[model samples]
Target: MAVRISKILLVASIGALLLLIALDNVFDYNTNYEIVSHVMSMDEVPRDSVISWRSITNPTLHKLLYGFIIFTEFAAAALCLAGAGKLWRERRAEAVRFNAAKNIAVAGLALGLGLYLFGFLGVGGEWFQMWRSATYNMQQAAFRFIGSIGLVLLFVHQRDD
Candidate 1:
């Protein structure tokens, strides 16, 4: 029971975190937009770098991509919150039922991991060479998000017994 509750809380916390991040991106639009713009533009990366050719210098595309990112975050948050609620309601159910209830939470965590790992770390960090920028680098922050989401995902994936 305690473990079940712990899992519920952890999943909820990730939902809350993603919700806050999405809200922040919405409220403070320009700030995060600038980060995305810089990363996509690769403006801060070394000028002579070979990957400069990969830079997306279009402002319109930046806004579109950022919007997609925010949308994904919101979707993940909603899934996690719903999953946590489902888990809470199923806490005392049969082990199989409780285990089945984890599907939503796992999907949410996996979505977040994909965003941070593939979107930010892979596309923004590696493809755009965001790591080369002293000012626009977000790999560390992306890594942290990946780790947190991945850990919760693993914890929540355990079968209830």
Candidate 2:
């Protein structure tokens, strides 16, 4: 039962993290939007090199990207919160039944992993060269986010046998 409780707590903590993330993005919309905007526009690239062509000059694209990010965060938060509830309800059930309740949490974790790893680290950091700007560099933060939730995802994925 200790293991079950641990699993439930871990999953709930992740859900809380996701909830905070989503709320931050939604409530403080412009703050992160500015980050996304600068990263995408590459305005602080610090040099007049031809690499500037890679920057997005359109304002519409900036809002679109930011909106997409917020939407993804909200989805992950909803899934994680719902998953935590499901896990809590099944915490006292048999091993197979408890394990079955992990599906939603798995989906939530995968969504978050994709957002941080693929979206921020992959596209924004590498493709957009967001790491070059001291003002807008979020690669480290994104990596940390991925790592923390990823460990929980792995832990929660283990069979309850």
For model 1 the local lDDT of residue 4 reads: 97
lDDT values for all models: 0.93, 0.87
For each candidate, give its TM-score against the true structure.
0.97, 0.93
- Ten contiguous residues with the weakest lDDT in model 2: 44-53
Tens digit of per-residue lDDT, candidate 2, span 44-109: 885586677788978899998888888888888788878888988998899999999999988988
Q: What does the lDDT come to for candidate 2?
A: 0.87
Question: What number of backbone clashes does candidate 1 have, counting pairs of residues 3 or more apart or in separate chains?
Answer: 0
- Per residue, candidate 1 scores C-alpha lDDT tens digits across 57-136 of 88999999999999999999999999999999999999999999999999998998899999999999889988888988
Which regions of candidate 2 fall more than 4 Å away from where they truly are?
46-51
lDDT score for residue 65 of model 1? 98
Each candidate: RMSD: 0.8, 1.5
